[model samples]
Target: MMTTAAPFRPGDATPTATIRTRFPALRREHRGRPVAYFDGPGGTQVPELVARAVADYLIHHNANTHWRYPTSEETDRLLAQAREAVADLLGAEPGEIVFGANMTTLAFHLGRALGRRWGPGDELVVTELDHHANVAPWRALERERGVTVRSVPLDLETGELDWAALEAALSPRTRLLAIGAASNALGTVSDVGRACALARAAGALSFVDAVHYAPHAVVDVRAIGCDFLACSAYKFYGPHVGVLYGRRDRVEALDAPKLAPAPETAPERLETGTLNHEGIVGAAAAVEFLASLAGGAGGPRRERLGRTFAALHERGQALVQRLWDGLGGIRGVTRYGPPPGRPRTPTVSFTVAGRSSDKVAVALADEAVFVSNGDFYATTVVERLGLASEGLVRAGCACYTTEEEVDRLIEAVGRVAPT
Candidate 1:
């Protein structure tokens, strides 16, 4: 069992200094300078508590599930606890949580299962702004199951979803709607609740790729009304693992491919083979760490997480605005995604005129300011922006990101920009 950490209070100031100490990677140096990790949209740095939880699981309770042995029983208990932790984070029931290798893998698995019910003339709705993980799976279904796939267009000028196009794409034949809560490349927060409601009205299932949004917002599965949702642990300061939440009735009905002897259950039916036990433990610890930020002792974990994300969202907004303004001021830099005042994650993607994204990222790395370059698996978004060959540079804020780091990144980009 994981021990409770000290509680924190909601509306309290962000404990930036204290939080930075929990991540050892923040101390890393590159090229004789302290490293600044602005590559949070790619993956955030994990906390010490998460690492310790993984290590403890492997060192002490390393065993498979469903056996009479003590270690096996412990493994079962740990998995259950991990489910509950993730459930609290997403406002879902423990039985609704399913663990897998990562978001892409889980999405593909779901596509195969969901496709079993789809056929020719049936449609799957996708978006131009989504990461390929959400697109490719549904497209594959089109080829394998002869299901028709339609896309919702994106408005390049504002970096927001074109809701009118989405409305046109939905029909009674639309079997499922695959959408992203936030664009991984451009950081545009979509109207997921409205999209889900639209799909429901059309008698279609909704699948949400929340891998980018989960780290930044308080996700309520019930509020969104999505039939299925997927997120990655690595995006939220945890080990590399994917979590999927399916409505109980929907999950129970899926004809997922599995072994005969495997436990036939809603979540278990979707999860194939043995899971990464240590990673699951680490994921639970990550959720606990987020709850601790709120500091409401003796309160429900879900309530604490709600408060924590509210505080995080406020702090992230200020940091992101600073980044947006700083980057916008730099000559030759063209920013993408929603502007500072709009609803979006604290992620900024931009390109410098006369410079490739990869070259600019390399220049920043030399100064120990790390940011991601290229399509970031959102190839369609890149192509739609007419940046297929020259992908954009992405910088995102995290729990430990500071104003100094953001300033450093801006300065580095300015120096590297074409004069």
Candidate 2:
């Protein structure tokens, strides 16, 4: 169904010096060689610490919470620590964080619970640029709650959100505004602060999916002023886990469907049943690993966490810029989002004319460079761009990505381009 693009080789060069001094898990061997992962939008490879924590949680503390036994108490304590870690990352109260299988599950649960409050003619705005994790749940909510779903359009040519269009979509009845921190399809980081402001002015709850953006950008729910935000730890070098950060008041206000008998926790109410405790522990470990990579704070716990997040932002921006520059110079390639030298994070999406995206992905894989080649669950954006049927290649970067990896991917892209 597709033709392969040209082939390119990754020439040998001394790797970037500014590499992670740690991350043995990421430096994993495949066929006796170091692996390179540019498919961060899909999932990030975790660090050894994260893996160790997961294994440790399972082997050493294999018990549920709240039991009178020592193991159960320990499990509860570890989880409490994890909640605090997540809260520190989002700059929110630990009680404000909710755990679930992944972002989609949390969004669906939150959407449905919040949907109970909506009625006919009420409105919600979902951006075309968001992954379905953020879009579908709201749409289901609209159908169930008699609310109207409004879609914010985009400038397809540049893969940028049409801010004016988004403003027009807002109204007094907009009960919720669903947006993504970054486009998993186009790598376009939305103006979450601006969107949140508009939603607040309309008295609507603003929920953002930072899943794709988390590895490449910094997230602070307080800074964005969002009512709720969800992201997957797996997308940021942890286990396959989802985390939700809710404004303390907003989370407390919503009565998510749960075992009513269960004690009311801002997060626990929404968390519902027993969860993947091991994964939660792993997620916390991943955050710790990233915080170390983030630098600027080898000091206090909370202060170091904040410093680490900011540092990731700076480093991610630099790596992404190099990736953009490398991809921009290639012929027949049309890039999406923030252009080559913009302040956007390191995830880059683009299409090679005349070659199907699936084929392009394979071509790159042949050169040992991995990338995603589909709607990437960012259905709305693709449908809006009329590329729903023909997705593009997405080569994203995480905190651990190196300049050599970027160069190898760029060179591979040039090879994958079919004439």
Candidate 3:
């Protein structure tokens, strides 16, 4: 008999009181009021442990890789450990993790490498819901390599992808399918595993942008069955660093542009120049920080991460439900995206009538309730929604977020919402 897994309860993970102590940013006061950070989707506040990890690496073991010196060897070892940490986080092999400046840079580099294998007759598929970071790279190939780019339309009403349009976009000539695991703006979660399977059936490779999704949900690259995936460390409370996970064979066979003296290995070949050694160390620490949230949970780091994410997902759903209902009750406040009880993250976006997005954001800032405004690099989504001029006011919940803070945000927005 098939049985459903039990839902994660608050007791399964660490308490918010303990979690709040790890982030110093939560203590900051703005205009005599405690700041409520609803800007997690743009980037999360860093924990003390992650900062200490970066500082420790910089102060003591900072050195270039592969020299015979102690610091160099330590640097090499620490980098390897970081890879292992990220591997556990994403359910991939350590060697498959490639470090870079950010997700956008990594995507551009990968696009160029993959583009070299395609020509006039080749086609690439992307989605309207994707951040331009995912779309721009592949689109660049159209100008540089004469490839056709097809975009799957988003269902505005449901805030989901049009499966029929996605199927129509794929064919034998399609070389790659670039998509996002979650929408950073509206928080809509896509069924990427099914999308990847479709790409495979159409004889195409799949690339998933998980920058926004990784912080909210557990990412299992193997289960997703994507050839490549990219995420940023800063988005997940680490220092500004990007990670790219490519399948072993695909990475080994990549025709990436590099110097002859650079290490000609699967991952190192994909990396260019000296990496942010400190940032990479902190990235791994961020992963550990997440796993640590599982409290006394036993077994491997990956299993602990699974528990932690389950609990976080439960908390996020509760927050989204409250946020959605509160905002819906406010007059002239129109929310965009899937309602609660659907596939989505804790992030929510909306616009208040008679108020521009920037104006609303500034008003929230006055109340020390932080939020992000603008298209958030998902320009196409805003353009499609016909809010290109005013943009969107986005609020996101994180591990550190509390019910009090959510209520404060809703209250603050309600104050400025048109009557």
Q: Which runs of model 3 end up more than 4 angstroms from their true locations?
A: 1-10
**After best superposition, candidate 1 residue 80: deviation in angstroms?**
0.3
Q: How accurate is candidate 3 locally (lDDT)?
A: 0.95
Model 2, which residues run further than 4 Å from truth? Answer: 1-21, 25-33
Distance from true location, Cα of 112 in model 3, Å = 0.4
Residue pairs that clash (backbone atoms under 3 angstroms), model 1: 7-295, 8-294, 8-295, 9-294, 9-295
Model 1 C-alpha RMSD vs. true structure (Å) is: 3.5
What lDDT tens digits, residue by residue, belong to model 2 across residues 59-116? 9999988999989999999999999888877777889989899999999999988988
Best by lDDT: 3
Tens digits of per-residue lDDT for model 3 on 54-127?
A: 99999999999999999999999999999999999999999999999999999999999999999999999999
- Which model, 1 or 2, shows the larger lDDT? 1
Clashing pairs in 2: 6-415
Instruction: Go through the candidates in order and give each one's C-alpha lDDT.
Output: 0.93, 0.80, 0.95
Backbone steric clashes in candidate 2, count = 1
Deviation in Å, model 3, residue 6 alpha carbon:
12
Residue 61's lDDT within candidate 1 is: 97
**Backbone N/Cα/C clashes per model:** 5, 1, 0
Best by TM-score: 3
lDDT of 1 by residue, 19-122 (tens): 89989998999998989999889999999999999999999999999999999999999999999999999999999999999999999999999999889999
Residue 220 miss distance in model 2 (angstroms)? 1.8
